[model samples]
Target chain A: MRVALDILIWVLFAFVIIGAIPVAAGAYQFLLIPFHSFKNHYSKARPHLPRVAVLLPAWNEGAVIGNSIERLVKLSYPAGRLRIYVVDDASTDDTPDVVLGKAAKYPGMVFHLRRQKGGEGKAHTLNHGITHLLADDWMEALLIMDADVIYREDSLRRMTSHLGDPKVGAVTAYIAEGSADPNYLTRFIAFEYVAAQKASRRAQNVLGALACLAGGAQLHSRENLLAIGGRIDTSSLAEDTFTTFNTQLGGRKVVFEPHAVVLAEEPGSIGALWKQRLRWARGNVQLTQRFHKVWFRPSKVHRLGSISFGLFWFTTFLLPVAMILSSIGLIGLYFLERELASTVFRVSWFLSACTYVFLTLYTIFLDGPTGRRSWREALLFPGIISLLVMIMAFAPGSLDHWLPGLFGLQVTEVGQEIWTLSVYAWLSLSMVAAWLVKKVESTRIGRMLSPLLIYFVGYGALLCAITFDSYIKEFQGAAQVWDKTEKTGRVAA
Target chain B: MSGVHRPGVVRAERVTGVSALTGLDQAELSQGEATDRALTDEALWREIAHNRRAELRLVPEALLALLVVAGLIILREVYFR
Candidate 1:
């Protein structure tokens, strides 16, 4: 019986170590990102701009459609060369009218096509637009853009600059959250985009395999598009991912152009963010289902089979599930035996913490001047990662003893396993506090306190809660449909 | 409306359209259902196999797990005993 019990403890300990693999791998990847700066692959600039068609898919996007059209009009590309196609997906609102208004003003430059029966989804709408564009082969390339995303004046030029390379199939730009006075949720998204796009995607680029092109800011060469079937896959929730993989599967490179920045309005509320992230999470799960063969036995023909891409993609979909299970298992083991569990937990955490510290410094270094200025955010990153690791390792309720003592309150539960749910729930208020302080930032106190809360719990714990919920939903195989994030046109041009 | 026990009959409707710009008729192309790649039992099993294979490839991860577990065992032997 004692031997059996020992075996059980060992098994649980193994689970904890296995679960930390994703986090360790993730930190390692971030650490490697900065090294890519020295190895630059420079492609010569094109002598002249390619004739490009911008495909905008809209469904009930009346709020930001006009602004989007205006932004497209102001793009640095030649008006004679670039054509904007606004494909209205049977929007019940005034979306068609707005496009028609723009079409009337721009005449031949801007065109409108409406899908008679709508809700066919973004991929189908894009296909409809592609069919229209294919009728005239005058366009050399196409840009698949979301209606709410606004490209900076030079962003289009930068994104297409890489298309000069004959081997490059598609180029994706960084999509930054663009609310002028962003709330806490948007601010978190802002920091996340910097890490994901500016850091991670750049790292992937060094390996010649990018994970996925941003659906909002993808530019595909006309030849490359036709090579991998003219239409986007309508069956998958992640049509963009399918397109990205297909582009690579057809023996072409999809490059991430970090200089090209597109401003997009992300969801502002937790509920909205949850729905959006759930759809994204489910799409990733579906991608794994669809491309299991690609990962299992990657052929030389399929460039998406690279180790870097596979590691990022699989960990993204599976880590949260593993973390939750390992955490619970650790808690159970702790209840059975105390010192044995503590020693193992501390050792594992020490290794994870060192990785986190290295990753945080590397991320800040890669981020350049702006990142350095926001050192507060960078400093909080290690703490955030450590706290998350602790929570996932079933941090004892005694951990809260530190917090209560610091706040001068009595601790209620000692040495009990504290489920992170309550901690996250209570900590979510920092998001509110950050938003409130930001709103009142004209005052002295607001200016001093807002950035701290914004970086600490507002960005950190709130994001974890949303991510944890997404993992739970995906694990349960919950029915997921694309939930359009509401855009209020608060983003500046 | 009174109903009796009778053979159930189902009716189907066909819809088609021609694009004004491209002049291409839909026929069955647009109307037909997209490929149903719904996660099947076979596909799920295949995915499980794929993940298992992936685990075999993760030698470093396996080593990390073993080392950590071994540490705990040693700690138990040294201190608790």
Candidate 2:
């Protein structure tokens, strides 16, 4: 019995180490980001403008479609070379009428492609337009974008120029959450984009393995599109990611153009954000299973199967699992060997604290305007309580000393032990808090409380909770329904 | 290429008499020529120079961030100990 207990303890430690690996890998990815300036594909890119077709998939986007069409017409690309194809997905709104009006105003430049049957999903809608565009040779390159995204004047031109390199398959722009008056949720999203797109994508560029192209701003060369079955993958919820992987697997480079900016309206409330992110999280789960054979098996054809890429992918996909496992490990250790558990907890969280500080600071430095706007969200990304835990982890008795003093109470041994145990359980407890944040958003008093709950639980934790929910849904074989994030024309150029 | 006849595509009015390959008409040929002229070797070099400058600017900022992180680690080790 003693020997068996010892082995169980060792296994718990192994789980803790497993959880720490991803955090270290994430920091390592950030370290590689600075190397992007040296190891980018800029030299091979030249000034080349192909005849571009902008495919806009619309489903009840009448409120934003007119303005979107107007913006496309005013883009800084050559008017003769650019054409807008609004693929109306049988929208019951005034989308068709608005698009037809634009088509009349900008003849030959703006075309309305109506689909009689609709609600199939974005991929099917895109494929409809793709079939029409590929039938003729007029479209040398295709730009697939959402109806509500406002592209910067030179964004398309920059994306097209990258296609000058025949070796390059696709280009994706940095999508910034540009709600005219951003609330707490949008601010968090803005910071998240800064970290995900501006920092992580740059790192991926250096590593030469992009995970996904932005759905709002993906530009693909005609030859490359045709090479990958002449249509978008309608099988997965993450069609953009499917296309991205297929493009790279077929031996062509997919580049992220940071200079090319596109503004998009993100979910403003917790309930809305949950629905939108659940779809994405579920899509990622599907993609992981679909490409199970490809992980960690390096291929000469593509880097999708490379060890670094696989680590990045699996770490993100299984982060919630890692968190739960790590918490279990620490708590088990505390029961069996208290002193060792304390030592391990301190060492592990010290590394986590260091990583959090460096990553948050470096992300702020990545984009000037976004950094300025969302710096507070970036700082409190892990939540106020988690940040305190980080501080306590590294500086062992500091919180115990200061927190009790702040409350004007003496810290007893029993209180200290309870606090220690609570800290150990916080890794998993944070996710519970995050789950409550979503639940609270739907209540009568939730509108007032949800935003406050998000701050206390942390947006990162909320995302992790959603991902955890995705695992449950996928396990139960829940029906994959495409939930459209409703957009109010909140984005300004 | 002359007209739209695809299934489910209700309305598409395409401009005819233009080269499908080049996508330029007779009237727009001058405009295309001007665009081509603007994309000269010198212009390409100028853009490259701007990009290089931007990239060079990042090196110091990254180094500074690393230094600050290093300082933080030192503070934790010294003061917390």
Residue lDDT tens for model 1, A114-197: 999887678889999999887866667899999999998768766665675677889899887788767655655766777788
Model 1 - which docking category?
incorrect
Best by lDDT: 2
* Candidate 2, true inter-chain contacts retained: 0.23
| Each prediction's DockQ against the real complex | 0.01, 0.18
Residues B35-64 of candidate 1 have per-residue lDDT tens digits of: 111122232233323423432322343245
Candidate 2, residue B39: the lDDT equals 38
Put down candidate 2 lDDT per residue, A353-414, tens digits, no spaces.
Answer: 88898888888888878889888888888888888988998787789688889989997888
